[model samples]
Target: MAHLIFSEDEQRELREAARAEFPGNPALAYVLENLAAEGIDLDRGRDWEDLRVEAGLPERNAEAPEVA
Candidate 1:
């Protein structure tokens, strides 16, 4: 199989589409794994939050809350 390359804008669009269409589905995770395999660090910088909000998901804290 040939490897596919995506431009930054295309990547952003893909992320948005995946998140919006599969917010609660494993497909979203699949999309992100594929992107990671292509060297896109989705967890880096503000990409995570930006993508989630852009996809109409609620904003969430990056770090987990402390347990009592």
Candidate 2:
């Protein structure tokens, strides 16, 4: 298995981008999930929460639409 690591700056950027391009194209999210399961680097180490911070991805509320 592999590991994923990311910096603060990278985290922030990823979150922004994700939210900016929300609806995340389910396909894209699926790809990331697949990569993660395989121990691959998806979003360059920026996982769900970090992806939001890095890509500026909107906060995903279980009761709301996912902006990633």
Candidate 3:
């Protein structure tokens, strides 16, 4: 296994990207665990959406957006 280095800004970007991909708490937790194994700490509280908003990432809707 190889060690990877990420800057602060890069870490922030990675967190946001992960949040965008895994909107649900369970899915997000899975992602965090994988990241932790890689030595990157990206854990969120119980409420996943709340964490996303706190991180300045856009909130994900439970339902799909209505098409015009």
For all predicted structures, in order, the TM-scores are 0.41, 0.33, 0.37
Between prediction 1 and prediction 3, the one with superior TM-score is 1
| Clash pairs (backbone) in predicted model 3 | none
Per-residue lDDT tens digits for candidate 3, residues 1-68, read 34555766766677777766777776775676456445533342247677767899765566857545
Ranking of models by TM-score: 1, 3, 2
Residue 40 lDDT (model 3): 38
Using lDDT as the measure, the top candidate is 1
- Cα lDDT of model 1 by residue, 11-58, tens digit: 777777777777789766676747834755444546666787789975
* Candidate 2 deviant stretches above 4 angstroms: 23-68
Q: lDDT of all predictions, in order shown?
A: 0.66, 0.56, 0.62
lDDT of 2 by residue, 1-68 (tens): 34665455665555555545656486675554444344444445545686669888677678896444
Which runs of model 1 end up more than 4 angstroms from their true locations?
A: 30-33, 36-68
Give me the candidate number with maximum TM-score.
Answer: 1
CA RMSD for every model? 11.6, 13.5, 13.5
